[model samples]
Target: MKTKTVYCLSGLLLGLLTACQPSDSNLKNQNVALQLQQKALNSTLGYDLVESLTVEVGPRLPGTDKDIQAVNWAVNKLQSLGFDKVYREPVQVPVWHRGQAHAAVTSPYTQSLVITALGGSVATPEEGITADIVRFNSLADLKQAAPESVEGKIVFIDHKTERHQDGHGYGKTAPGRSQGAAAAAQKGAVAIVIRSIGTDSDRLAHTGMMRYQEGIKPIPAAAMSNPDADLINNMLKRSDKVTLQLFLSPESQGTATSYNVIAEVTGSSKPEEIVLIGAHLDSWDEGTGAIDDGAGVGIVTAAAKLIQDLPQKPARTIRVVLYAAEEIGLVGGKAYAKAHQHELHNHYIAAESDFGAGRIYQLDWNVNEAAVNALQQLTVEMADIGVMPGNNEASGGPDVSMLPALGVPVASLRQDGRDYFDWHHTPNDTLDKIDPAALAQNVAAYAQFAWLMAQSEIILRPVAEKQSQ
Candidate 1:
């Protein structure tokens, strides 16, 4: 009886050990598959995609004929790449045209100042408007100044942006460009001029979208080149009175139709669950839109293509979205959320790549507690490529930011954006700025994360509350 009991206990311990240990052969096969996919993505496929888009389609501003052409191009491209389904969803976008713009310091110094009209700004009269300049060091200073000090003046907000890898400086300084016009108008200023929200000290001005509050009157707004802003500051130090003449011919052309291009790789098992990857398609019309978003399109598209080519389909669908009118605002993103509100619960995970072709350095996520272990395992798999794990507070970029509000999980593969703002929305944002190696690195990181998301069975959100006994 004692010998029989010993044999039974030994058999039970052996069964438990076998169940706890992973099959080495299966693990080896998975590693080999991942290695093969990464190697292919780090090749020339990603670069070729960006090159074709930037060269063939060029800048695709929202609500323009080129925008339509871009939508068609993306559809054809995705179909050619063998996506299961490709389609376009219409989005109504505001059309704002930038005509001719000129600014000159007329009084203290007669010199032409490099400037570009901010998007959505009202047109200055054909003859132009000349006024004494009131310079403020920052937007907060402008807000605190007495109304009598700014009435009928050209308010200049001269806050400078700093360089940082994480791009926090752009967030800190962007408000001056986005809201300065409305704030100045509220204070009775005739117009507002701000230093370009860029890190470079170049002569080219960066132009982006600005907003006017509902009740606040719209006014002419522009961004001066960094060097020109410095010139204005120096002149203000010498003399309090610096008069300027500004002429801008921008006008709103009302609403126009744009599209969000979507393509998908169908899943073999759970077709209803989705892993979304996104990037914006519209640009500011200053350059070829190479680094701003053309790179992002290439990265995500190439990642999806790589996954689709695998011998076996993933467990969940991989959806790639090319959003529209992101430069103006997140119009396409907002429209997508509204259109797909009912199915948002099935979005297993979401991410976006809009911060240029810089190499990804860290991974951040906003998933459920139950999904944390899987994310940690993914980070370990990506360690060989120089990516580290980050905190859980992820914004998932501009296009998919609305998802988190609806309880959809999101992640961010944070890229090194130290020099992103230098050429952002400027004429300098051209194809020459992108490095092929960095672009390849971006594809590798994105492809790995996307694959993990599509393969895992982990539910990313809506953690069930513990049952009461």
Candidate 2:
């Protein structure tokens, strides 16, 4: 019996030794760590943050009192979240107020019209301006019209939108809204109105920023609701000599100081290397900016919070930037680029969630070929969260676009934009529009990506000149 026991003990010791081989042990440890990370990220809490932002601070347009309040709210929230550092950087933003917008058909038929001021549009006089309405089937037609034909007339360029996942209709139909003022001014038109570039058939109008050329006259511009646009079209179909009146009091009220809210979670190992997550702080003034960016604020902050809660610190730092005035010509993005130009090389990856709180369907990236394999691996890890590989031509969000010039690699978690344009920049944008499950999924994806990127041995691509050397 003693001899049998000795033999059994020796066999057990040999088996243990084989199992403890370095490579096998490392693999076991890796699998265990991965499981822990997955568990930590599984109970994502993005909805809590998003709900807090949408319900608490709401509608943070730049230069407005609400915008300032939002900055204060974000600062307090970040500090409460246990971020290592939370601060605000001031950005001098253009202040344009939409006082009141009114329009009506005077000649062919008398009826009221619903309209909203286009961003950056100059206000019309108090009494408003009445002029003969000229109809243009498209931008090309407006451009070819005789100057005298459009002089002192309100130009209407009616172009319909078609739906696509990428919001391609916006690109195809934007010429009317973006250049209508300048194109009409060049043709001697007084003011311009275009059909809202949205796929929805509802009466709500979508408003966005519009630019006038340097030398051209800056005229009042506005977008009419789809139904109202139909009314105008119906009137024009009967006669080309319809008369219209427009009254908009949108004005530039000098200058105001808006701020971008920033926070950081320090890393244990490579502290200098940085991963950035961002969302726009400023929203359009019409409605609460819930879907547009409140969802974004929720997503990034929750991701950071999850990382902070981890037992071990990530290998690299994570920065959360809530940009200001993204709605008005990327004012905050440009300011951030200029302010952080020196640290661009340190940015390992930057991403922003600006689209509505729809489910994230795809992930795009803008990094060198070397980064693809790593991102592909990341995609597989996030597959349960419904994230798929997307186009590599990632331009990033409006705010994140500024980072690439500094050679910062970008990651894109593309959300489902199927219904984004419906409530985007419209008065209907509210907290109820967000899906709690979808928001939580977003948090899960962001948390996992940020954590793995921070912890991974593989150095991400777009390694700046300074880092590579």
RMSD of each: 6.8, 8.1
Per-residue accuracy of model 1 over 1-469 as CA lDDT, tens digit each:
0111000011123213111233443354346336644675558777888898888989888999888888988999999999998999999999988998899999888889999999889999899989999988888998899999999999999999989999999988889899999999999999999999999989999999999989988889999999999999888888899999999999899999999999999988988989999999888888889988998999899888887887777788999999999999999999999999999899998999999988899998877654555466544656667789886778888999878878788898999999999999999988888998888888888877887777664456652122100
Candidate 1, which ten residues in sequence have the lowest lDDT sum?
A: 1-10
Which parts of model 1 have CA positions greater than 4 angstroms off? Answer: 1-33, 463-469
lDDT by residue (1-469, candidate 2, tens digit) is 0111000011122213111222443333234334433553565456677667767777777898989988988999999889988999999998888888999999889999988989889988889989988877778888889999899988887888877776667778878887889999887888999888777778887788888989888889999998998998888779877888999998888879999899988988889989998999889977788888888998888888877877777778989999999998899888988898888888888899898888777888777655555456544546656788775677678798767657888877888888888888888888888877777777777776787667554445553333222
> Which residue pairs show collisions in model 1?
none
TM-score of each: 0.92, 0.89
- How much lDDT does candidate 2 score? 0.78
lDDT of 2 at 342: 85
Best by lDDT: 1
Displacement of the residue 330 alpha carbon in candidate 2, Å: 0.8
Instruction: Tell me the deviation in Å of residue 91 in model 1.
Output: 0.6
- State model 1's lDDT: 0.84
Could you give me the TM-score of model 2 versus the true structure? 0.89
